[model samples]
Target: MVRYLAGFPTPFASPANAIPANYAPNYQYLANPSEAGSLIWTLNMELTPIYAIAPEGPYANLIYDRLINALAGQLLQRPIPENFAGGINGDAYQQARTTFSNNFVSRVSIPGYLTGKTVTLFSGQVVPVITPQLRGLYAWHTEILVENAIATAPEEDIARLTDALTGFLDRIFFDLRNFGTSSADRALNYAATNAFQTASVLRQATGQGMQLDTIDVDRSPFCRMDSDCWDVRITFFDPENNRRARRVYRFTIDVSDAMPVTVGDVRSWPIS
Candidate 1:
């Protein structure tokens, strides 16, 4: 199951129209507060699952299933992109939309039944019967809100916002790397103990250092999941030599359960 975590704005509340004039644009000069200010905009995502199949036997099936589940859990528990700019209205927003569009088109184009196929019944009669196929894609969407805070400068405010957003994306990438390494290591260790001679080859083939190429998450109101969850898809790539390798795998993670909380240094106190 895919899980998405939405971002939260600071100060808990926001101004109706614009920020206050006294608000400093620089992070260094901004007052330290714990409560949110004003409501800004929200960010959301979409998630889909990717499956890999091994070329061997029943063991291959087992490994494949385990890997898929591992990836799902890893993505759900990891941090996702929190930057609102990188989301809907951000520079990379259009690209994400296009990617999702293509995904849907591809899924819909798949043939449900082969027209020219014939089948033989148990009664020894041959008939042209429609063979239903289940070749389809799985996808989901989520949304998150970000409270807008007044700042001294627009540029400075955007920069700070993006920084916070990138933090979530970075966390996801970090967790993915860790997950891949652990999975590969476990597979290698098992092979070493069970297969002995082939362990070295397997270990070398599935080692780390593989780079993830693309990560695309849908960024539209249509892709939202209520006030706080969204869907996302992340693509992974492998390196063959000094150059880039062919596209290897793709995974989608749906984040929902996690709630957004502002990060700052102000504590709430009661009037004495």
Candidate 2:
């Protein structure tokens, strides 16, 4: 992740448009409240995909190109060139963009899919208002994981239970995600958990509402250490208006069919 630091007129000055099929966060100021300078805004251009994409797809370069162009726009923004009239800032931005563009055009690894770091790009501005440097070109090691829940009952019975529970959760999050008001007893997933008196983010989401994407069984690869665990993720969202508000309901159930059953806790993972 590139940490860009700039003092803008308003937080809204930075463009909010982004690359497609990727996750983009809102322009936010520095984490420290006291250290937040005037109109400090950050633009996190994430290149990773929400779903899998082949390396050389037809639309692969579309987002990458747009991102480079956006960076060029930022580079050409005022305070930068004014401070670096000697020409170092322009040269560095062009070089980084060139390297990124070359890798992109050659069908090499897309820079967007790589892991990002939370760096302080402009530690202390000196001659130039802001100093931007490209870092990290490490090979990515993505883990493919999927876990299946243990079924003590017959296949038909398990399917019915999963379906019923899925519907119950869909309705539950409708209220929780929207109003931020839910009791432990009212939630089916939370009730299933051994020790959730419902004091969790699971019951604390603030948004209009979220749609239920999928509640089916997951069969992805699993961690050997957690072989006894059953995994289910509930994906939901208000796609058009709040893509960043996409959420997931994740839970690990201990295979009850085994000698000792272990059912884990309930939680929510915000994909946005």
Candidate 3:
């Protein structure tokens, strides 16, 4: 998910007066500064839930049953007197034999059966029962938070925030470049150039491309250690392909050194 915060624009004086006699101003500016253009964007996101399972039972009993079954087939040895008989020789064995015989007699002999004339008949039947239980192991919830700062005029706070976001984007692009291509610096350049071309083509397709006349970059005033700035101009072809219309976009980015760089050319041009 992604969210965007439209920030206030920055206003400044025109540098047209600084142009030399042979140079021309790229865009006209008011003698007095006004609010910069508005930043517009839309935010979108989604939420999803995660689920897990758990089990419940008497773990100790289960372990004991498993252990007994596993060792049941093992052999055991005990010493006995050499002349000992198989059964009924010792008092302990006799007692044990008597107890077993009594248990068997109790199961087979019914009381009051001596009354021969009357007999009772019994039918055996068994009923089965089943029970099941379910438990929830874990539950999950997702949330999305979005914030926006809309300014009627250019503000320092907006610039700071935008600068921070641009830095983040630069790192992301750098890493993407490294993974997708091979060189990070080249990747950054490719992305920048592509952005310019895409904007140019989109505007041209919409009839606004003709309004663009030229594009350039200004490396001065951009902090080398913290920020990157670029000046882009979009130019429109004239009817005679001589005269042109143009617009400029000044972009600044902040990034870190840990980002990966991409390699190779990323330009895609239409075949004419």
lDDT of each: 0.27, 0.33, 0.25
Expressed as tens digits, the lDDT of each residue in 1-272 for candidate 1 is: 11111111122132233322222112211232211112111111122111112113334333333323222322221111232235455444344344333222111111123246454444454544332222221222111111122122255344444333233234342432221112222222221122222222212223433333443333223423453222232233346554544333212222221212111221211111
Give candidate 1's error at residue 195 in angstroms. 32
TM-scores across all candidates? Answer: 0.17, 0.24, 0.20
RMSD of 3: 42.1
| lDDT for each residue of candidate 3 in 1-272, tens digit (9 for 90 to 100) | 00111111221234222212111111122221121112111111121111111112444233222222212211111112221233336554354333323221100000010112221212222211111112111111100000121132135444443333333334333433221122223234433433333332433323432322333323325445553332322223444434443333333322222221222222222211
TM-score of 1: 0.17
Best by TM-score: 2
| Model 3 alpha-carbon drift over 4 Å, by segment | 1-197, 204-206, 209-215, 220-225, 232-241, 254-272
The per-residue C-alpha lDDT of model 3 at residue 155 equals 57
Clashes of 1: 31
lDDT of 3: 0.25
Count the clashes in each prediction.
31, 5, 19
lDDT of 2: 0.33
lDDT of 2 by residue, 122-238 (tens): 544212122121221111111100002213335544444344334443344344322101121112232233222221322232223444555433432463465544455556677
